[model samples]
Target chain A: MSGVFTEEQEELRRYARQWLDENAPLEAVRKIAETPEGFDAAQWSELGSLGWLGIAVGEAYGGSGFGFMELAVLAEEMGRTLYPSPFLSTVVLGTWLVERLGTDDQKAEILPAVVRGDHRLAVAAGRAAVHDLVARRQGTDWVVSGRARFVLDGHTAHTLIVEAAADDGTRLFLVDGDAGGLERNPLSVMDLTRPQAEVTATDVVASPLGDGRAGDAVDHALDRAVAALAMEQVGGAQACLDMSVEYAKVRHQFGRPIGSFQAIKHMCADMLVGVESARSAAYHLASVIDHDPEEAAIAAPVAKSFCSEAYEKAAGDTIQIHGGIGFTWEHDAHLYLKRAKSSALLFGDPRYHRAVLASRLGIE
Target chain B: MQVVVCVKQIPDPSGTYTLDPETHFLVRPDEQVLDDTDRYGVEMGLQIAQAHGGSVTLVSMGPKGSMQGIRQALAMGADRAVVVDDADLKGSDALTTAQVLAAAIQRTGFDLVITGTESTDGYSGVVPQMLAELLDVPALTYATEVEARDGKVTINRQTSAGYDVVEASLPAVVSVTAGVVEPRYPTFKGIMDAKKKEVEELTASDLGVDTSLRQRVTAVEPAPEREAGVKIEDDGEAHLKVVELLQQKKVI
Candidate 1:
C-alpha cells in the first residue's frame, strides 16, 4: 500500500488505458479537434458518469472522493491518448479553485453542478503579477472589465472564473459566460486537441469568489494545476517512446530491422530514460501535493520543468526515429510534437518554472 | 443465488517465461497477475450474482503470494474469496487442481459455479469438467453467453459452426469462453473497499483434500526455431507455381 503505486492505482491505470484505447483513439481525437466545441458533449457526460471529472474533488460535492494521485492517474491516461476534452480547464483548474477557495454557498452552487457535468468552467488569468482584468465594487455586485488571452476552453464554458485586480489586491470573480458586454473569440492554436480563446469583458456583472484577496490562493491553485500538467507530460513522453520503439522493431532498413542499428537503439534507450525519469518526477509531485503541501510547493516547479523538457525531447526523437513518414500530415507523430510544444508553453514553460524553482530554493 | 468463480494466479503472460529443466514446470516469476482467461468467468459470475440476489465468492489455488490476483477479482465487485495456498500443492496437474478447487468451493457452498475454459498458463482445458465430476454437478463448457433463472442456468454454447443453447439445473459448473462479456473495471470505491473484503486462506489439509498428482511431465523440450520461408514473386506464372507447390504438398 505504501509503494510508489498502490495496487488500486495500477488497476485504475489498466482500466483507464483500455477505456481510452476504445473510446478516444487518436483518430477520434482528430475528429473532435475539427469540431467547433473541440469535444463531444456525450463523452463529457460519460466521463462524469464514470466519476472521472471529480476524481480529485471530495465526496461531499458529489465527486468520487479520491485525491490528487487518482487525478494524476486519470490525467496521465488522458494525455497518453491525446484525449480532446475540457478536462484540464474545467476539472483540473476550475473545480480545484472552487473546492479550495470557494465559500460554503459557492461550493454548494458550483461543485455539484460541475461533478454532474451540468456546467463547464474556464479560468482567465494573466501569466504574471500584472493583472489584465480589473474589478470595481458596485453595491452588492461587482463589475469586471478587461481582456484576458489564452483562456483554455473559454469560448464554450458555462462560466468563467476571472482573476482581476480590485482596489485592495488581486481577487477572483465568477462571471457568466454569456453575460452582456462579454466577447469570447476562439484562437487558432497549434495544438488542435486543446483549444484556447481570448475573453474580453466590458462592465460584466460578477460575483466575488470567497472573501479577501486571492493572490496566495491563485498561486496555490496554479501550482497544483502545473503539477497535474506535468503528469500529463509524462504520459505523452511515454507514449512517444512506445511509438518509437514499436516502429523501430518493424521498419526494415539494410536488410534488417532498423532497431538492430546502434543509432536507433541508443535513441530508443534515451527516450526510455527520459520517460522513466519524468514519470518519477511527476508522480512524486502528485504524491506530495496530496500528503504534504509544503513539500509540494517545491516539487511542483521542479516536476513541471523536467517533465516539459522530457516530453519535448521524446516527441522530437519519435519523429526522428520514424523518418520521412513522420514528417507527413497523416502521421500521428506531428500531433504529439505539436502537443508537446503547446503543453510546454501552457502553464509556465521550462524556463519559467526553473526560475521559480531557483527562487523558491533561495538560489541567488 | 450464491455464485462461486474459480480463478488462477499465473505469471504475467507479457513477461518472459522459462521452464525448469529438472521439473519440466514453468518457472513462475515474482510478478504474478490474475490469469487473463479467468476474467471472463469472474465477470460472468459477478453478473449472475448482481442480476439475482446473492454475492459472488472467488475460489482459487496457487502459491501463497497469489492474493494479488485474487484481490483483483475482489476489486471487480466479488463479495469474498477462498484461496487454497499450500506448499505441498506445487506442480498441481489439471485433475489435482480441480480436486483442490472442488474442496474449497464445497466449503463455501455455491448455488452456481463458473470457470474459464482454460488458463493461459496451463491450457489443459479439463479442470472445469473434472471439478463438475467431483462436485456431482452438470458441466457446461465454452459458454459464449449465460443466463440464470428459476433455479436453472441457460448458456449459448459455442460450437464448430454456430452455437447451441444448453440448459442445466441449479448448482452447475459453467466454463465461459473469452469475450463472453466485457469485464467491468473496479471503481475507485470498490478498489478501496477490496482491502477489507474477506479472503479466507486454506491449505490442502485445511480442506482435507488429497493433493497427489495423477499426471506428471516426462520430459521437456524447447519448440523448434522456425525456418526461413520462401517467397514467390507475383508474376504471370505465379499461379502455376502456387498450384505446383500445393500438389507437391498433397493439399490439392
Candidate 2:
C-alpha cells in the first residue's frame, strides 16, 4: 500500500507515459478538442491497433481478457495527458457492460467491432436516462421514446446502448444512433476533452442486449466506469502536481525559487499527497473489482468520492501556482481545471458518491 | 529462434538519490525504473521472436528490484522471465554480472541473446562482451539494426563513418543501440498477461556463482559540482575579459 503500482504495472505506467508524451501531447489534445468527434478516427484507430479497447474484454470477443487493473493502468495515463479519446466511454462503460452481461450473440456482434475500432459506441445508463424515455412493444421489435440526457460521447457514437424504462422494470437496449426517431444534440460541454450529448428517442427500434434486466448490471457498469474515472482523476492530479512543482522550481519570487518558500513547498507536498491518496484508493478499487466483486462495491464509492475532489483541488492549485498565466484561455491549466470540474459531476458529485459510500458502510 | 534479453533495473535518475548518511553506500529507493536504453533490446527481441515463431525469454541479475525491469520486458510480450537475485551479489562488477546472466541464459535456452549497449547505473558496456565470451558465441555490439533468418543473424554495427553489416551464426549475442524500432507500449492486456507468465527464480547457489570475493566497489564518490562560469558583458573589451578569464582558469 505504500506504493500504488506493482513492478509489472510500473512498466505499463512508463510505457504509457512515453507513448502519451509522443502521441497525445497537450497541443494535439487542444487541437483534437476542436474536432467534430473531439477525436479523430486515425488516432482512435491507432489506439485500437494497440489493442487498448479490448483490454478487459474476453479473448472470444477479440479482447485480451485482462482484468480491471489493466484498464485502470491505462485510464490513469489517459487522464495524465488528457488524452482526447472515447476510451472511457467505449471501453470502460459501453464495451464493459456488453461483454459482462450481453448474450453470446450480442457480444459477438459488438465487441469485435469495438476491438477493431470499427464501431464507436456509448451507454446511457438506465439510472441516468430520463424516466420519460419508455420502451414499448411494437410488433416483434421494441420501440424506445423519451430522452437520455448526459450520454457520454452520445453525438459521435454510431450505436447507442440506452437504459429504457420498460414494463420489465429498467431494461437495457442497443439502438442505432441514426435510428429514424432518434435525435442526438451534442452538448456544449466544459471539458472539451470528453464530449457528451442528449439523445431523444421517439419510436427508435431497440434490441435487448440479453434479458434486459437492469438489476445489478447497470450498477456494475457504473462502478466499473467510476473506478476507471477515479484513476483518471488521480492521474490528472499527478499531472497538475508535476506542473506545479516544475513551475515552482523555475518561477522565482523575491530573487529566490518559489519552491524554496515554505508556502509553495507545502502546497506542492499537499498536491503529491492528494494524488497518491486518490491513486491508492483507485488502485484498490481496481484490484478489488478484479479479485473480489463484492469488495469492489465498497471501494468504488470511496474512490469516486475522494478522487473527484482531489483532482479538482490539485488542478485548482496548479492554476494558482502559475499565477495569472494559468488563468488564460491559451494555457493548458484551465483545460485541466475544467475537466476536473466536469468530471466531478459527470457520474454524480462527491456528495452522491459519499452518500453511496455511507449506505454501503451501513451508516446511512 | 528463442531470444533472451538481458535487462537492468535502475532508480529513476530524475529523482534524488539519497545517501545512507550513516554508511557511505547509496541508499537505493524502492522505486522501480527500467533502464530506458534496454527497451530497444526488448523490442528487438520481441520482433525477432514474433517474426521467427519463437518465444523471447528475459534474464536479469540484480537486486529483487530487477524484477521491475524484467516484468516490463515480459509485459512487452516476452514469454517468461528468469531473475537471479541474491543479497551477496551487491557491488559485483560487470564480469560477475555477466557470469550470472550467462548461467541464467544457459538454463533459458536461447538461439540469440540481446542486451542494451550499456546500463544506466553502470555504463560498463563490457558485460555483453563478457557474456558472449562466457557463452562462446559471437558478440555483435552496438548494432543499429538486426535481422535473423535461417539459423543466422546479421547486424548493422554502428560506426562514425557508417554502419558495418556484420553477420554471425545462430547462438550469438547482440547489444542493440537504442532507436532500432520504436518500442511498442505495453498494452493493458499485455501487462495482465505478463502477471500470469512464469518467472523462474534463481539464486547465487542455483547459478553456482561464488559472489563473495568478486570485484567490489572500493569507494563511491559523487561527481564534483560544476563551477559557475564568469559572464562578461558584450562591451568593446568583452573579448579581452574572456581571454583574461580563460588564462586565469589555466585554459591558456
Candidate 3:
C-alpha cells in the first residue's frame, strides 16, 4: 500500500530500509542492548555520517533543512524494530529543544556536536509536584535544589536539563552529570531496556538557558516531546498487535488455529481499533506542533492520553494471546508490556494528561 | 575532455510488457529513466571521465518529457546533461535518430560518446555505427571492457563467435553491452543534489538537422497474443514433446 509520502520521501524510506538490513540487523540491536551503555556507538556514528541525524535540522546548522514529517518517518521505523539506542533522548528531545531555545553561541557550539552524535542529552523534566509549581533562587548565582524523578535514560546522558525553581518563575537549568553537588542514581524500573533515574541537585553548577521566559519555552518543548512520544507509542503498540496476530495464526488449540476462534478474533480486532485511533491522534498532534504550537499544546495532551492507554491495552492483549508461554521469564511479551507501561508514564500518565487537557480547555 | 552518454527512458522493463490489441506500438507509461543498458553506458562514461580528469555530459534525445532521463544521469555522477527535444524527431527511424544525435554531439565538440547497444523498444542496435559514419569517426560496437588512458583507447568487443580486443585513438564512439559495473542507487543526499543539476534543451532547428528520413510511423496496431505453452509434468514427457515437435517440423 502507498503511504502519504512523496517520491523523495519514498527514496528516504527505501534507503533507510536497505541501510538497516545491511548495517543494523537484529544481531546488532541485540548486541547493543547487551552493552553497558545500551547503545552501539559505532552504528550511531554511522547514522550521523549518513546525514540521518540532521534530517530535520536547518542547513545553517548543518542539517538537511527538512521537517518533523521526515523525522517522524524515521522514528516510526525505529520503533518498529525496538531500536536499542538513545536516539529518542538525543535526537528527539535533546537536539530539538536545543535548536529552539539555545543561544546563538550555544547553537554554534552544541548543535553540530549533537548532529555529529558526539554527545547525548537527556531532559530531567518529570519531578515532584512541588518543583513543577515554581522555581527557587539564591544570592549572586541561582541555586536549583530539587529532585527530578522518572528521568528517561537520565543516568546515561552526558548533559541533563534540570527543571528548577527561580525567583521569576519555573526555569530549565542545564546540569552536567558529573557536575559538583549532583547526585545521579538509577531507579529500579519495570522496563529494563530503557532505564530511568532520579536526579538530586544540591547547589549544582548549572548554566541557565535563558534569563526570562525559560518556563514557557521548556513547556512548549515538552508539549512537542509528548507528541513525538505518542507517535512512537502508536508504532510500538501496532508492532505488538501485529506480532500477536501472527502468533495466533500459527499457534493451534483443539486442532484449530486460535485466530479462527471468535474470542481471539474479537480481541485482535479491538486491538486494531485502539492502534488505529492512537495513530490518528498521534499524526494529528504531529501536524499541529509545527504550524501552531498553541493548538498543538492542547492536542498533544489528548493524544498522550489516548496513546498511553492504547499501548498498555495492546501490550496486555498481546501477552494474553500468547497464553502459557507468555508468562515465562524467557518470553519477550513481558518486556514489551513493561516498556508500554514505562513509556506511557515517561512524559505524563494518561490521568495527568487528561487533567491538563481539561484545564487547558477550561473544562473544570 | 567532454564525454557524452546517451540515455533513453523506457518503461520499467522488468514488469511484463504487453501489447494493446488496438495499438501495435510498445506500451510505455508516461515516465522516464536511464534505460537499463544505457545506465551501464553512463556509468562507464563517468568512470572514464573521472579517471581522465575530464567532464562527462549526458545527452538524451526524446520529447521534453525525456529530460528526466538526463537528470537521472546527472545524479548518477555525470557532470552535466543536454537534451534534444523536438516534435518532428518523434517516430523517426533508427537512421534518422542517429543523424540528429550526431548533430547534437557535434554541437558540444564531444571528445567521446557512449550508448547502449540496443534500446528495449527499437532493438535496432545500429545507432553508434550510423552516427559514426555521419561524423566520420572510429566506432566500436558491443564493447564489454573499455579503457581510456593517456589519450589512447582500447576495447574488448563481443562478436558473434568469439571476442575481438581492438585499439583505437581519441574522439571515438563505443556502444556498450551490459557487464561494465552495477549502476549505483541514488543516495539520500543525491536526490537533493540532482534538483540543482542543469539540463539544457535543444531543438531540431538549433541542430540544423533535416527530418527527411524515409521511414516514419504511419500507423500502429497491436500484435497478436502470445500462446501459453503446455506444461509437461515430467522430464520424459517434456523430452518426448520436444522431439515430436522438432520431428514434425522436419528438423532432425
Per-model DockQ: 0.39, 0.43, 0.17
Report every candidate's CA lDDT.
0.87, 0.85, 0.75
Q: Which residue pairs in model 3 clash with each other?
A: A135-A165, A135-A166, A136-A165, A136-A166, B23-B221, B23-B222, B24-B221, B24-B222
RMSD of each: 4.4, 5.7, 8.9
Model 1: lDDT equals 0.87
What would the per-residue lDDT of candidate 3 be over residues B1-252, giving only the tens digit for each residue? 678888887766656665554533456565655576887898898888888888888777776563555556676678777788887776678888888889888887787888889897778888989988887889988888999876767899987656899878878888888876655544456666777877788988888888765774556556779999767677657888878877877776
- Candidate 1 chain B: minimum summed lDDT over ten consecutive residues — where? B63-72
Report lDDT (Cα) of residue B207, candidate 1. Answer: 89
Q: Write the per-residue lDDT of candidate 2 for residues A16-82, one digit (tens) a residue.
A: 7878898879999999999878887897887887877886788998888767877888898899989
lDDT of 2 at A295: 90
With candidate 3 superimposed using the best TM-score fit, by how many Å does residue B224's alpha carbon deviate from the native?
Answer: 31
Off by over 4 Å in 2: A2-28, A40-52, A64-70, A127-139, A145-149, A165-171, A178-185, A198-203, A259-306, A329-331, A350-364, B17-32, B80-110, B133-136, B187-252
What are the interface RMSDs of all the models? 1.5, 2.2, 2.4
- Per model, the share of native interface contacts recovered reads 0.38, 0.76, 0.10
Task: Give the per-residue lDDT of model 2 (tens digit) for B8-67.
Answer: 778787787776555444566656567889889999999998998998888887776646
The CAPRI classification for model 1 reads as acceptable
